[model samples]
Target: MNRRQFLCTTGAFAGWSGGVACQARAEAYTVDRALVLVDLNGGNDGLNTVIPIGDPLYRALRPTLAVPHDQVLPLDERTGLHPSLGPLLGAWRGQELAIVQGVGHDAGNRSHFRSRQIWDTASDTHEYRDDTWLAHASLPAASFVASCTDAARSIAQHEAAVVRIALHGFDTHENQALRHAALLGQLAQGLMMLRARLIASDDWHRTLVMTNSDFGRSARENAVGGTDHGAAAAHFLMGGNVRGGLWGAAPRLNALDTGDGLPVSLDFRQLHATACAHLGVAPPSSVERFAPLPLLRV
Candidate 1:
């Protein structure tokens, strides 16, 4: 499939039938809020992204890959953020950004394709889903928005309540520090630009932006100075209505699952339910097993 078709099938507009159908039905809707999802396609290294400085295990496990305590941007006494995420420090300080920790579903799958499919469909590891959870949930018309291209402009120009932007390149099997830093820089810069545009257009307060990934990297770096597939990464939710300030429990470095990955502390579905609640949509009964997380205002 072509890039646009691939995006429509897998990205934010996954559920909608077609653009023509969406535009035709657009007049029937009255949207008061909006949601922007940034999908980090490859598994992000959560341990490095959100450093656990207080945990000695972190330093020992990731000796070569660990970000030094002095270099990390302090979020609290125990935990800090990667140096590349310095751009978001203002958002954290202003309480507009929330860090949701230890997010993953049960039975973490390590393969990129399988794990991402599971995350996209919001299905249990043992169960297979033909349709994505986003498709099942009632959403506003889907508009194809690519992050690298004119994403901010699209959000400013269109009235679509749900906009998704898919970004890749987090795999990082080699030279992780350089590659991940560049990717994180792009993310931080893109979000900052989007925020500026929204504020300029008076849509900042009404828009919610969140980030998700396939899974997380292993707590321990591999022999190649990179990480393998793991589980339970950190996510971010930012908006004016969001009650931000570190929403979930930090992942314990010493308490790893059998796969030597962080244990799932907060189910990803809870975050989905929270997003549905924020958008005034009900999550499908098939996937409503978890309650909506109290991350945002009703």
Candidate 2:
């Protein structure tokens, strides 16, 4: 109905419930599902990550940074994944990965602090809310934070109700080619390995692995072989129950906003709501107005 109420249902879906929601319902959903959040610490380059190989405009936009068309791991005739993320191909084939493209409030607010606040609260670009979504959800909003690169391994062992991981080194302000390649390789490997571990422990089916950054990098490469911060990013969702495949329209490179950034096709709240729906939480009327994304299996 209202912004805070929208976030209230959303926080539960985002895995910040902290058992507070469960206490009221008697601990039913506690052990069944857990959310694994992979926060690409800095803005990730979405254009390169989800390469638009068929779009001539993409190569024109980032000639130096574009992955050779021949090398792209083809998802469709028009779309492909960066070579560095080759490890994820198996999941793609198995239908365990869902790629949501053009996700963000808008191509505005390039400031990392501001963008993250907006995401954390599921606020639209035009609105800013002080309270966190978790507090509104009636959850204590607790966390079990570990900053190590190897924290994924540790996270598998503990299996908290929710785990938010920050993979550093995405802020590729200079020399983005080499830096982004290495980071993407690491990301792909980490995701594949995490899935393998979950499968071994019989937790893969219930664990949802989602990735997002503060925002997305510019659609065009800068003179320094890097990109400046922009708005809108493509995100990935992987899990046994995930309805794996591409979702939403690709970022419209030909049609750029005033910031020369891709316009937001699907609001970031839609992504949050998809995850919330996966956890069987009803969307508040506000998010429901955006409609449903069948991101999870029935």
Candidate 3:
């Protein structure tokens, strides 16, 4: 098509008057890009994982549980990460890790079964849905996986658009100090290896890795050096397309909920919306109302 012919055919594409080039960018999924969901099966203790090292309340609330100041991987003056997550520092430094803090629903439940249902379906506390949130978004269903390496391979090979990997044993009701550290260590190692493989295969930019859980553990340490079921946990989003750094406020340790849980600062649905849009797809009808976070590169 010559200039005049092209202008006549596509001039109105973006309300163009033919003085300059007009382009149309469709809002649809890029079939080649993959979304991987990592489920931290049991409730993760957000406080210990993403420590507020500068907060005096953190030490007071978890005298036996708080990660020591020096040992915490410093992210800022007020925030730090668990030493076990050191492997993720490269992603952090490379601006591939975006941390979403205090994420939960206002009507969040303490029961693991009920809360998991809410997250899985992306429904209101009083609502119920048999299908998953991704199904509502009209995306492909996730492929179940036992290994991050396997999931990374699939993404690299273009085997799946969506994959779910579950890591169990986050419920730390006893001996949490040791147990939680080990679990975080495993998570960091798996993600590091998975990221390395993706980077090697040239799939890192087209792949997004997100982590989730049933809920968060309580802010206050228990008598047995552990935490109970709580709310408002932290989550991570990693990919070359990500705009890394902290996205939400660190929970106020001084002002916990009645259940001794951190206050829900950012709605989890917002995350769903952001993820959907990040993939160049519109969010599901229910999730459309929530504002998408600016966590991804344009």
- The most accurate candidate by lDDT is 3
Model 3 RMSD, rounded to 1 decimal: 10.1
> Residue 147 lDDT in model 1?
50
TM per prediction: 0.87, 0.82, 0.86
Specify the highest-TM-score model's number. Answer: 1
Q: Point out where model 3 deviates above 4 Å.
A: 1-30, 135-146
Model 1 over residues 1-298: C-alpha lDDT tens digits? 2323322332445565333233322233345566777878788988888888888999899878888778898888888988888988877877889899999988899988888778778888987887777631122232222352344454455435566676678887777887887777777777777777777877777778888898998898888989888889899888767877887888888789877789999998888877777766667665578897776755
Residue 79, candidate 2: C-alpha displacement in angstroms: 0.6
Candidate 1 vs candidate 2, TM-score winner? 1
* Clashing residue pairs for model 1: none
Error of 2 at 128 (Å): 2.7
Q: With candidate 2 superimposed using the best TM-score fit, by how many Å does residue 155's alpha carbon deviate from the native?
A: 7.1
Ranking by TM-score: 1, 3, 2
Clashes of each: 0, 0, 0
Better of 1 and 3 by lDDT: 3
